[model samples]
Target: MTAVEFDAPAGLTGRGAGVPLSRWAAQWGMAVLRLLRSTLFVGIPVVLIATIITYGLGALTDTNPAAQVLGETATPADIDRMNHYFGLDRPLVVQYLSWLGHALTGDLGRSYYTTLPVTDSISQALPVNLSITLLAVLIAVLLGGALGIGAALSGGGWFDRGVTLLCSAASTVPPFVIGIGLIVLFSVTVPILPSGGYVPFSEDPGRWLRFAILPAIALAVEGAVAIARQLRTSLVGELRENYVTGADVRGLTKLRVVFGHALRNAAGPAITVLGYSIPQIIGAMVVAEAVFNLPGLGKLSLDAAGKGDIPVIQGVLVTMIGLVVVSNLLVNAALLRLTPHARRQQP
Candidate 1:
């Protein structure tokens, strides 16, 4: 009989565990540092370049010049005052630096058309836009995801075929066209809902939902169809995996196996698609706002364009860019959190 003994390393009781723990902590710290550096190094420069371009374009397209073209009501002195007021009289580089500095300090300047603080304008309008967009997205996600689940489960039966057809039809129609059609049907002929304008949720909280319902539906249709298609594809892929087959073999209820197990696992990629959809939804805001005549940021931006109001245009552009950048960053962060594989990667 032979006796076998295993030798342990000195100072290694629980030390190996501490090593991996420390390594993980250091990795997370480096990730945070890289994020901050990227924001400062890459994002700052992009913001600077965007500011310069926007400011230059603002100066070039000012109401002063266009007003001059239209035979100005204001005298040369008044025009000069206006230019100075907007910092348009400065050298382009200086103007950019000054604007960038103000921006970093939370100063977005005034609306050229309204002569009101840009911040005030945004504060007044953003809520309405945000409300409408959020409602639309919620509707899209619920309806789309359910339809996708049904379609995937049916696997090309009549119900799946019908859903696919509906989505295809929806994807073909432009949001603006949808808005107009809904307005004609519901607002003009049926007279069931308001065609345009916003009623603050506080003013008549009940009316707010009805007022937004039509436009929200119109706005949501395209997004819903797109989301549904993506979800269905992902669900189908997930269903074919071995784990799902094993679940099916275990005598689990079909609904539980599909919804609880397969569908949830498939949701990761679908959520990523939904994240990218945020910007597209924002882009739709412009058309939806104009068509609905909603008192929202989109309408404000468009009015600025019509008047060639440089300050307002610049403010709107900066706000939209900020939204897009923030949305992308947040989506990436959420994805990284949800996907464990992403967080463990080398920088």
Candidate 2:
């Protein structure tokens, strides 16, 4: 009698402890490359088009950039000279190309009001805003997922009904209104958390969290509610599927049927919804930042608009477009991993 075992091919063999890590790594690497290709193919044209559109709108405005730069009292000759100096006299396409080139090189132009480089302002403010938005989004997704799974597993009891009602009501409330309510509750009554302000996380993470909490709540609640509702629906539908019935019929344990099978199947649509919510999250952060008086990208954009600081505004919008593009790319790559059909298509 003889015994022999076939071994995996070297490349297919897992690199460490027989864990199949190499296989996993290969899948993730392909996903990353796909993300890069999508970003390059789609993101670049979107930015260019946005630049052209924004620049054109700004150029066509009745408000004079020269007047904004100098003063209303500047003479006609002064205005002409100022316009020429700023290259507003050049063809619109030339101006856009010049600005785009500078932007690509990290020269987003000087703020007409601040005289500081717009790119520098964006770099400084963007991280803070990103921190808040990212935190809020994390909170929303985690809490929403928990609530949904809990409700789904509850099997339509009081808990499920109550959760559904709560999510519905919360989703209908505007984020600003929620922010105000949170402020009144936490700041005025409790007087615990800071109302709103920016603190560098490096300097004091505690202070940063305290300052960020209220705004994050306001920004997170509505999204959380919507996510909860969506996930609950998806989970419920997944539970009703024939595969789930077969799992139960085959005597799989309750936990395995519910989580291992049902939740796994429900995740794809929930992820798709979450991916599409990134822009809305950014928009909500703008309002939340303004309400909280945080010195974030949103606040910078708001103030720049108020002062007619077109360059800064342009920088902010461009930054937002980049954020959305990158977010979409990451989301799509992640989707490929979680979705069987998508992975099949990729290979």
Candidate 3:
């Protein structure tokens, strides 16, 4: 592969020197297509395998799905009739095919536990999960990014040492442990914040904050540490660059040059890492939600699994996989924006 350069086009050239707008656009388009293609090739099979494993686990562990639906003490005839109606009597491959076909059409069938449509269950659960994850990510990124930049600017001062020590400890502690600590501190010791639970923000914003604070912090801690450490490294390296020094020598205030100029260049790789790390937030939410007793997708999936609610379980798995795929796409595009210099130019 050749590293070629072309003259910048119009308004885009000024943002970064000699970045050819046309070439950048083409490269970005190709990156998107490649990401989509690769994701489909990998994601589809993984989803199918996950479905097979989930369904198989249920079949092995759950002696009777029909009994769960129709009542455990129901007569054999009713159980048989229920099984027949639910197509639980069919072979594994046949049942999987039927389910897959319906899934392709955006129909995940009905829940075995509640007998409600699977989409309805997801609709009810998805918002809670989204709220927790989004809030956590926002808090982590802002606070962590600030700490990282501050540490870099201060070099080896007390501030830098403090950030290093704090982020190190926070990173070492797992999210579930953090949740437990928060519960112990806030709920038991101080008696200020609610230990854990969910209240819809639409219904009562005040109560919702009380419930949301601990969980969000617990969920954000590890991620914040993650972003801070990675970003601190990037910023430390950027601060010593010629351009940064030049800006500093040009009579720009220390604060202005370090933050305004140095931080932007440093942020590219940090943001790229942050983008790739978003899924960790989602993964941590499972532990956070369960620990907090929140009725989010994590808890819902656990309940569905225990009850052999195959539809809901499958729906949740697929939804999570879709989120990961979409997050990766967004992150890739964002990475391009952040590190525009990384874009290749074709001769």
Candidate 4:
């Protein structure tokens, strides 16, 4: 080839490669910054709102503040001293502001029930709650997805009707009722499983699984049923889409046509349902935890609320609100990423 032609082709190829590289670099940079904004910027306002509501309610209430700092025999002076010590004497707004300031810095204050720092207790307990929640979500997604896909493929036939009816029956029952039923069935009649109560997995792996299995299953039923129905509907919709028809006409196997070609497209609507399900799942976990006596966040929050433990209650609320907010943001981001049309419209 001539030197001129060679140089021209090389230049053109290099420029083409550079364009995509520059575009990708820009996209990557934007994604990183967006994540940071999502985590720190967006999360802060939500936490503040939670703080305002939590501390605001705490101030207006006449609940025992943080496990009675004053002794039974303490005089008025001692009570005053105690109030001053815990900043209970301060104005409501001022106290909230102080709490807000400390909270923003990750200082969740002291717990009345535990005499331990609120931050420490939450830090220890959070992993447990988070682990349970995650496991439950995992279970829901897998089993729910399977049941949903199977039902959709069966198309209201025997398998489909049975699965759908089973989920309906399960969902109709409350978590506590289900937990009690399972406990009675397994622990009373069958004597196969422990009745209730948590054991550290580290202490005894077998007991941990045995105890957690029923609670996790009980907690998952609602989400599982909901997700499954949504998935079945979504899959049906996907199957109706023209693209799915085109795929089938192209001679793809039924399994490939259904799963490989259609399932991903089916996931878009299901994702939305999953997004909404987050809070509901957490609420369900409360009863499930109570029934099982699992020391997860649900039980902790209940204990906090029952005793009017402001610090613990605030801590739990903030954590859950933060989780939900972040989850929602993530869902939005994922949806936008998955559906290019949405991202293109956003600056």
- Candidate 2, residue 90: the lDDT equals 90
Return the TM-score for each candidate structure: 0.82, 0.84, 0.88, 0.82
Tens digits of lDDT, candidate 1, 230-322: 889988987887666666666668888777667666666767777777778888888888899888888887777777765666777777767
Local distance difference test, candidate 1? 0.74
Each model's lDDT: 0.74, 0.79, 0.79, 0.72
Candidate 2 per-residue lDDT over residues 230-261, each given as its tens digit: 88888898777766666666676989877665
lDDT of 4 by residue, 26-66 (tens): 65456656756766776788778768887878777776553
For model 4 the TM-score comes to: 0.82
The full ranking of all candidates by lDDT, starting with the best, is 2, 3, 1, 4
User: What TM-score, to 2 decimals, does candidate 1 have?
Assistant: 0.82
Residue 49 lDDT in model 3? 90
Model 3, C-alpha of 139: deviation from truth (Å): 1.1
Counted clashes in each candidate structure: 0, 0, 0, 0
Instruction: List ranges where model 1 is wrong by over 4 Å.
Output: 1-49, 62-74, 345-347
Name the lDDT value of residue 284 in candidate 1.
89
Misplaced by over 4 Å in model 2 are: 1-42, 72-81, 241-253, 345-347
* lDDT tens readout by residue for model 3, 1-347: 33333332222222456557786677667766765776788778988898898778767774688887777579999998988888989998889889999999999989876778888888888888788787888888898898988888789999999999998778788889989999999999999998877898889989988888888888888778878888899888877766656665566698876666666667766777676667888888888888999988898889987777888989999888777777767776666565555444322
Question: Which pairs of residues collide in candidate 3?
Answer: none
Candidates 2 and 3, the one with greater TM-score: 3
